[model samples]
Target: MTSRPRTLIAVLVLVGITVSLQQTFVIPLLPHLPTLLHTTPANASWAVTATLIAGAVSIPIVGRLADLWGKRRILLACLAFLIAGSAMTALSASLGWFVAGRALQGIAAGVVSLGISLLRDHLAPHRLASATSVMSTSLGVGASLGIPLSAFLAQYADWRLLFWTAGGLAALAGVLVLLVVPGRSRPPGGRFDPLGALMFSSALVCLFLAVSKGGTWGWTGGVTLGLFAGAAALLVLFGAWELRTAQPLIDLRVSRRPQVLLTNAASLVFGFSMLISSLVFTQLLQMPTAAGYGFSESMFVAGLLQAPGGVCMIAMSPVSAMITVRFGPRAALMAGASVVVCGYGFAALLHTELWQLLVCSALVGSGIGLAYGAMPSLIMSAVPVNQTAAANSLNNLCRSLGTTTASAVTGLLLATMSTTVSGHVVPSRTAFTTVLLTAASAALLALVIAAFIPRRRPATTAGPLLATPTAVQRHEPRPTP
Candidate 1:
């Protein structure tokens, strides 16, 4: 296979770094957040939730903007938010200030989804597959490095420095993305859907706030119930509005395609399994030494153990692309989801040993890498080129929704079922076991959806991927079979 253009390759790597760094950058400070801000643990959770919620709300908006205006322009706009937000966070003296900074960091998530959409537009088809895989896999890379690096810095220095570093990184990426990437075909003429944006944003915040704070709010309390009701009603209104608007924020018809529908359903399952199982590992590792199956590893060691999974993901991405090509995206997706089920099954049975946890998690990571790599390809195939950014962003929103569900459900389980063993009220073996079962169930659900993916066999004869081919060399030239 011929190499991809150097500029194209550099842009992918930088975007990957930019996206990954945002999520993991705050891991090291999680433990100290409450004390640092002089707030309750429940209130401190908003620092994390703010960023995730922002990403969930902003993704579709920024994505649609990228499709309408230009991908590069939207990406630069996102980076500007990241730089400004991170710098503000570094200077903040209170919890409210920190949360503001974190909310801005959500814009970085737009960079990730939009960057992936642009890959389909600019890169040759063969090159696009692997490039997509690498960029998607960067989620794992950013997460893995961000945790350990943040821990080391937080342990030795002030946590505020973490945001300072992130700000600098964002500025550098903005320069690179602007200078290196090619411009789009042309800007489409359309105004931003302000009403849809408002409705969607309000709905997302209410739902996420309820889920994030439910642990402390008492599940049946007035606050939780009110938020849930408000979110549900707003989302219903948002859907109705989108359906009636002359120019809808999201094109609902495109989402009705079988390939797009199934890929998104599978993405939700993937998100649930990946986050829940990994968080389970964190709880298991941080358990007291007295627990026969537990260890008291520092935050650094915990991050270190998880690091290999990202490595495994990076190593497996090319293989994932090859599988997508040979057996079509449907079969490859089933294969990936099935593998993830096996990973969760092993976790349930093998938590007695550290080596078992690592091995099982590596299997899970491999499955996630493969499945995530295929999601964008599936979406692009189903939607028009003009809708690539919007469709991909919606797909990402499903993953986020799944993750939010996992976090809330697991937190509820652990909080309600706890046992005091030697004056420390840790989640009992029963609770942890229940979490494992729930994670396994999520994988099984994904596997079932993956099974229904419709087949779209490629044409037997080789031809150019697009109607008019560019000058860049494609990676997979037709075999001389």
Candidate 2:
């Protein structure tokens, strides 16, 4: 690979990891936030919820804007949000300021999707496959690494240092982009749809709010039902408006394509499957061993156990790319999803051994690396080059939807089926087992979904990928003897 592609991939991957640091970095700090921020536990939980809502709203919007404005330009804006948000969170003493900062940090989640689109705008075809896989898996890498790092920080150092470190890294990423990332000209496109954006944002907030808060707020409560109804009504309106508009925020027509639609569906299922580890494994490791299945480990040690899974994710990126190159992205998706199915299957049956669970987690992480790497490649192959960011962001939104749904379902299951150990209620072994089995089912569904994605059509337009005819010829697949 050329120095430019190598450097660009490194920079974008760094940005991906930096944004994902917020994913689980706050989990260890959550229980203490009530005392630290001088708020009730219920209100303190908003520090987490705010980020979820903001990320759901910001992700697709950022992608659309990047397609309309410029990838590098909007990317800088995202980095700015990260820096400012992290600094705000680090300095905050009150609950309100802290939640606001977290929301900004959530907006930065769009960076990963944006980076994938930016990669398509540069790099050669053969190189794009591996580079994209590495970039897509970087989120897992960061999230995996962040948990232990955050746990250690929360355990020993001041809590504010987490945000400060995140901010410093984001600032460094921004500087690197300024120096290394080549700027793309803003392609001629239709006007930005303000009304469409507002409607879509409102609808998303309603949907996500109901999903995230329903467990705490009461599933059958009037407010939860109201939010769901509101989301449905607004989406109907948003769809109509997008179809009527000259340049819609999301191109509904393209989205209806089987390739796009199926890949997104698979993404949702795969995302749901992936989050099971975060929700179930962490609790399983940290819960009191008296609960029968728990290990009674500290948060830091629990995090250390999961960190190897992140390493596995990074390790599998090249393998994922190789699969995509050899047997199309569809096969790659199915192959990855099947591996995850086995991972969860193993966990469901074997809970007594720590090493067994660690191996299972690593297996799931590797499968996720393989599957996630293929999603962008699949989406980009089917969509127009100009809409790469928007499409990928939409797919990301699907994954977010999956993760959000996973959190609610798993939370409900764990909460509903519980037993008391030493007078304190905890999720029962049956409930824990059910969650793992559910994740396995979701992975199997993803495999079934991937089976339906039409084979990747040969690249019609390499766009910015083709440096010259000679470079294109050099990158073409060689015939096997």
Candidate 3:
């Protein structure tokens, strides 16, 4: 209700927008980066993959850091990373520099986690759900809006303008954060778990590299298999380290709570389902019309066609809050996943017409808006206040895991199930259908998972964290969404 909270929320939303926009800036230029940066296409692909891997590794670490250090301080640090990366990218003259800049930009994705935790710390309990909902979906909103805007800038202007704008906005937002966002809380005596972060980050990088590059390297190839095996090994070590550490990166016991555990499982599923729309639908709209089921649209037009989906996400934020308030976040998540399933089902059946695809996208977007908005509330409902940032970050990591898996699955299916049309290889209708069905199935799986999340209780501060190795955090009253 005060000017301060309102300003803080606005500035953080702006940071979210800036962060999401940075993620997509390089996308429009990927096909041409080989020429632009004088590199091989394979090397150029790292521009995208680097950001993905960086974002995944940093999400959890930054969340824990925010809790241990200070939310506002860590947030400002993330903004600085974004601004520096953006400016570096804008000035990049080689593939190596560009990839490095992109990696730094990826680390800024933690601002979303910090923003949610900040809201929890700064706002009244009654305002928490709606504020967090809006903050969470801001990424989707920026992403949806960014796709077309970046495409336009890359085409019409010096492509460097995209990064320049990104840096400028991030700088403005950082200044606002320093002026408007107030207060910091760090529980005394908790140490930063650098070893835990290193093990986890290494595991994630290997896992993401294996998943993202498997199609190019052959799924059964030695390098791909090695990375997967290495990831599994590192993760086992990471878990053991967390269980033994005095101040672990993630509290494994607290994480094992039914609410937190199941929500994370469903978050991964939802992430897979949500991203399939982005990967599958955009291609369907851009393939040559001679392929018999294609629209032959420019990348910009295709992005424009899907723009409604992002709009629907923002439009549904308040609706998601209302649903969470009335029936609980579990119900909202189920409703959202159900909508995604229905949308994917329709896409599987009736994607022949342009309007039909639009309808499918709108439905999926609305569903994702509802689902994404509710996830934070669900995690917050289960974790101690000190661990809110860390827990939410882990949930986001699960979603990222789902997304990387989805990317692999869709890439694998499309590559294998292809046909040569007019002397050029093209993904067959069967591939598209199968991808849609797989996404729908994932959403359906999330619905099944959501059924088991226990109803929340009245709001109470979460119990003491990290008192001992065998400590039991409160399970009965973290408060339902």
* Overall lDDT per candidate, in order of appearance: 0.77, 0.87, 0.85
Clash count for each candidate, listed in order shown: 0, 0, 2
**Ten-residue stretch with the least lDDT total in model 3:** 463-472
Identify the runs in model 1 with alpha carbons over 4 angstroms from their true place: 1-6, 457-481
RMSD of 1: 5.6
Model 2, span 240-287: residue lDDT tens: 998888778998877887888999999998988888887788889988
Best by lDDT: 2
Q: Candidate 1 vs candidate 3: which has greater lDDT?
A: 3
- Model 2 spans with C-alpha error above 4 angstroms: 1-3, 185-189, 458-481
How would you order the candidates by lDDT, starting with the best? 2, 3, 1
The estimated TM-scores of all candidates read 0.92, 0.94, 0.93
Which has the higher TM-score value, candidate number 1 or candidate number 2? Answer: 2
Identify the runs in model 3 with alpha carbons over 4 angstroms from their true place.
1-3, 185-189, 457-481
Instruction: Give candidates' CA RMSD values in order.
Output: 5.6, 5.3, 4.1
